[model samples]
Target: MFFVILLAQTVIGQKITGTVYDDTKTPLPGANVYVKGTSKGTTTDFDGKYEIEIDAKHQVLVFSFIGYKTKEVKVKGKTIVNVTLEQDSATLDEVVVVGMAESRMMKREHVVGYSIARIPQNTESYAAIKENDFKDVIKNPLSTFSVDVDKASYSNVRRYINNGGLPPADAVRIEEMINYFNYDYKAPKDDAPFSINTELSACPWNKDNLLLHVGLQGKKIPMDDLPPSNIVFLLDVSGSMNSPNKLPLLKSSLKLLLESLRPKDRVAIVVYAGSSGLVLPSTSCKDKKTIIEALEGLSAGGSTAGGEGLKLAYKIANENFIKKGNNRIVMATDGDFNVGLSSNSEMERLITEEREKGIAISVLGFGMGNYKDDKMEIIADKGNGNYAYIDNLLEARKVLVSEFGGTMYTIAKDVKFQLEFNPVHVSKYRLVGYENRLLNEEDFEDDTKDAGEIGAGHTVTALYEIIPSKNNSDKENRLRYQTSELTSQALESNDLITLKLRYKKPEKNKSLLIEQSVQNKPVAFTETSDNYRFSASVAEFGMLLRDSKYLGTATWKSAYMLAKDAKGSDEEGYRGEMIRLIKSAELLSSNKQE
Candidate 1:
């Protein structure tokens, strides 16, 4: 009997191995493989190879990857099961519409010159973005901008790519894409809330130029040490959110977040559609069953009364306000607000006015075809909060569960950055991917001015493309009347740039300042850290997607190689997924060219 049992155990624990590939015969790295109806799973490596052990009862294996159709095969006692996935035809057939739609099935039109142009045809909108141009250091030595922790752009771009399409040029925000992945940086050892790090190396695209990386690592506070939170779930269950991915996926995502809450935390439920109402009063985490039941009971119908919903949510939060606690509203929706106060400026004004009362509102965007990204971004920015787009259940887990504290609590507000470049060492410079966040020089010191906010455990990164003074030695048209001479500090000192930062405590009204100086030191591209290389790769990818005019020598092939080589210590596999995305984009670009 013992011998027979051992043999059965060995037979049931058979190992299965295979390599996943796409239709083009290219290996699909980061593909997921698992046994049906089982929790056991593994992801393909850089070589598209995966191995998993299965029980006798679960002989069927499933293989899936982004941008490709999922395939399932019954092992039928076979050990090797190599599989090829086809591109999802339904995803590839999705078309890009530039305007909005009053209803899901209705289209609006306008006259453009002699032709008829569609207006609000599909309802998706993205705020237009203009790339930054090279600025003469002699003319403008100082560059200033607000720090942004919102990461909506990267995931939204991922959605477009995985759906077999390129994201609109205006939708690609390079800074957000780079900051999506975390970098290893030491925590602050002093009284400061964050630490600053800098790196300089040869530009990967333009070898003649240099790239300067600036990183800020926010202090990490353990969950036990975090302040008590008072949260209001401001959900939109309008007719627009009736789709399976919107309402059903959202409910599942919020359930995962419940597992992360502590007993000391409290939550309330407020829903809006054609009308706004309170579904649940402020309830303690101890009563989790009630919360779960309320979430599960939500249904989508009626029009979107987003403005009224905001007002009611803020009112409830203020009424149950916890002193010095994290008071926030997590609003989930597809951002389709056509009923009341729907304009971006109006929403911004409303949020700005209410944020002064010590309540923050973060936006969780969902759905795709009729998504209103522009409005959500504005509201989140003006409300002293962050924004994230949840494309799938996994993304929901990432935003609501994995990053609960960072997404819910704010450590610093009104965060701003100013850098003064030394004209002696740098002639021309361009601040990449912050055209919208750029602030005037005078706004840096103004306490009344509103800037960006940084949440706990958040990291903000910015890059600058620089042209050394040696390359600009020949002046085209030196000002004949007035010539600006380099200062003694610029000539004698080896400083490259001086970085200045300002931020306020979440509950404080005044801002605090911190400053640091970076010396002139350039390392070879091969010698830079993984963080530097990975971020550079993302920036290059964004530029390629946008078809930027400043793309000096960047190619899709270079971006893929850089990301694949620099994918170090990716515990969450996000960096590996980026490498795969680069490959997918490269194939799409090549096919388009052909």
Candidate 2:
């Protein structure tokens, strides 16, 4: 019958594919492409290419990008649709108020007094990082630190490199860069929340030394199995966020997140400007239209009252406290908090107090100029949550859609790592990155100490560079008053280190323990897994950026080569993008030298 044929036509959907370009014919990466009226959509990749399926009922495909005019074309008779989006003239003449004295319509292209373009002063800030130093195994055998799954530093650095500039030294966090990519480790099969994997291999930067890779793979839970979420959105609509990359991009990025939520999940909207106020009360995801409307109604103006916003958000979360559920605040901002309770210490103290009440806060940082990365990182760390930077729609999709469960669900909290090296096998060792996350040795076993949280399906990686016992010269310089002797078991055992991990269940206060013993046996660098090689490459890249004294023989060319070969099975093209970013960094670094 006609109805049966119509159903058959709908089932056999047609595929449409094409590339998106700007007015200059330059490929526009991260452009949005979708069926006009449905959630079936995709973003253009690094090459500005996209492919989406369409049925008879959905024949129109819409292409859109920030600052560009959206275009919709019919795909009924076409197999391909290439789009060239022109800049919106209306947006160029729109008025934005930057301060009390400055309120004027700015053009997309502004003219300077002379032909030379005016370069704006950079106001971005990052926390100072003192790189970890070597520790003698005989003197300090144990290395303790909290696990970090934050990926903000990596994307922030990428934004810098893509803008044709080298990032500030403190902007590069090696561990975050290494962990930005996914690794293939076996998932936990038991009741444990996560599985630990370790690898020993020759150090790529120093052939005479060794590299120890420790990875934790949080158990993956299906979307249906995840606990219902009570999410409060703490959005910043201050005047500083008036740029195209700030408020507008944030609104679009959050809309993409809405598609991933379920009917059982609830969301509330809170905004901070000259003052803080609630835009929408807690509402179920089933009423997505109301949520979307509230988001679209937001406009950037006034000073930032971030502290007041946090207090109100936490208050609402407490009022709607969902016991045995995921209660969290997803704060999106450029981190420029200039109003009341704006100092770093004050915000930290406030967040520290609220975290004890079973409410977590994840941070989604956006924008560039006047950015406050230092504050956002501190907030996320103290709030028992995670942090990520969204530089584009593609990155937003990665964080809010593809990794929805990992971004929203906490499987374990207060995850800590402590490694005790065997002096008989290793003379000295230094933890790579995580300088700020290092903890006192005794703090590892203390249940009251705060640490990091690992979300469902999140992978945390750490690296340590070690020197073999045979290369030690400390014995010759040992103090005459103190003579150390090795144990017979230490000399006979093949273990190089004993790794210990502690973590708590999402709703529990007490911590569970996981212990692993690493063997002294090591393989050649080339024989190691892609996970080891790729992570080493990222560490080397970070060193080059920071100009670290401990870089050894690491070079930009070497990092690029290592990453090129180890970018295995990058289905999402994230690894491939990292490879490109490496190449971009090399060019920028070389130009700086010139």
Candidate 3:
């Protein structure tokens, strides 16, 4: 049949192949691969093998992917073109959360380490404990929150946290990671081969918190700067969203999301109360009168049929889907799928299938008291989407309006980080966080495995604490059958940790690599680094709160202290809010105990 011949040709195009890896040697699951200059791509299976046939018209094939580098190969249709993707040192442009105006030195001009005091450094006595130790910590995607704080041998964790020794009085803080940035970075406009911009801020919630903002603009690629977006605001007006912070705050936050859409982009307001019903169908983005009217009509009262609502929203999106345009479904809810196909797994399945059909999901979580943090995180992770918590309206703008590229576009998918310690330079190392994103060492080289995605301008940061072999005075565990023994001549740790990142472009399947390094001695604590400091602070805060086994952290008090001390030239109000959050968390913890 004519159809059969077409299918054969489709399968016979030039074949290009490659392997992928995280900083560690693990096969990343669900990574995507495809040829450049074409719309054909396939995802890496569990084993990470991919082969797609493309025309050999231009023997040279361009391979691109998210998180990794973009490689161009001049192949007379080579069957195997193995590639190793590196990490991207540049970060995306987004609203950098610096502590708020509370600590804002408006009149004072900014300098690298201005208004910063040197850290009083003294090693903790407990640091003299047995060299290699292990501890426990719970982890998952999106975020980590736990009720039980202590259940493992922190061992030197306290020593790791304490500046000298004793309980921590400061929380190693970074507000930018906590807040996410406000703008998506754009490539450079000049012809100067390379360009870069960096930002720094203190925590907004805790006095000790600090936020760093890093931006890297690549060579400008001419593309249409489309007007706003045709966003469909879908609200779940169900009984489960009855909490004061849930539905009520959600209403207020939705108002902020609305502000981002312009009249040029079409927007429709949809809400699901007792059953699925269209409060307002598709409308113009500029028609605020119609939009607000529909939004105000929404209220909480009735069982939720989330499935029905989602189906209807997708219908509307498909009908109004913009080809080569940002057509998105913004879902705001507590993630209670009680009414229909409500299970987290069910929602994930539905969203996964929908992503291939071209509709994207953006989840904005509201409230605190009874919010489903885990459920929310999963839905976002599996849905090929971005998820954020909008505790207030200001946060709503940050997620909905501010950073669009880092938020909406998919630059790479199934991003996994892995690293291999050179026997000559390293002994033992511990990845700071990402307990959930870990992969087997073998998986790193497997290009077909699925991992995480990097947004258009987003920056992924992972830190590891390593102990040098020379510094380690412990017995070595030797491997059997090998001529070499660990005791013979163990290599020391690298003075710097080599950072490796891999990714696939939204339209292509083949992956590329980018790499950079971080010195173990670390930059001066008081020095200015908008991106690293903010990300570092977030990692510290997450560890402390979750009671991490290897945490260099503690209670809210110390967390706040670290953020405060790290406060640098924080033009953004992120750091200020971190201070407030510390105070709020302290109070919340107090009230819970009572």
Report the lDDT tens digits of candidate 1 across residue range 382-481: 9999999987666787788778877888888999999999988888899989888999999999988899888888888999999988833633337888
Tens digit of per-residue lDDT, candidate 3, span 248-355:
667777777666555667877667766787777778866777777777767787887878788888788888887766667888886665577667667777777776
**TM-score leaderboard ranking:** 1, 2, 3
Superior candidate under lDDT, 1 versus 3: 1
Index of the highest-TM-score prediction: 1
Give the number of the best model, judged by lDDT: 2
**Candidate 1 off by > 4 Å:** 1-72, 77-121, 471-477, 480-483
Model 3, position 579, has a per-residue lDDT of 44
Error of 1 at 42 (Å): 13
Consecutive 10-residue window with the lowest summed lDDT within model 1? 107-116
> What are the per-residue Cα lDDT tens digits for candidate 2 across 1-594?
999998999889899999998775756666667676555667788677989999888798877654456677888989988999876533212221211111221231221100222236789999999999999888898999999999999999977765446789999999999888889988987788998999999999999899999999989999999888899999999999998778887999899999999999999999999999999999999999999999999999999999999999999999898888999999999999999888888888889888988889999999987899999999999999899998877889889998887788889999999999988889889999999899999999999999999998999999999988884355344767977777787778989999999999988899999888999999877789999999899999999999999889988889988987887876776776676566657766665676
Return the TM-score for candidate 1, rounded to 2 decimals.
0.86
For model 2, the superposed segments whose C-alpha errors exceed 4 Å read 1-43, 46-119, 471-477
TM-score of every candidate relative to the true structure? 0.86, 0.84, 0.59
lDDT of 3 at 47: 38
lDDT of 2 at 186: 85
Give per-residue lDDT, candidate 2, residue 58: 78
How many steric clashes between backbone atoms does each model show?
A: 2, 0, 111
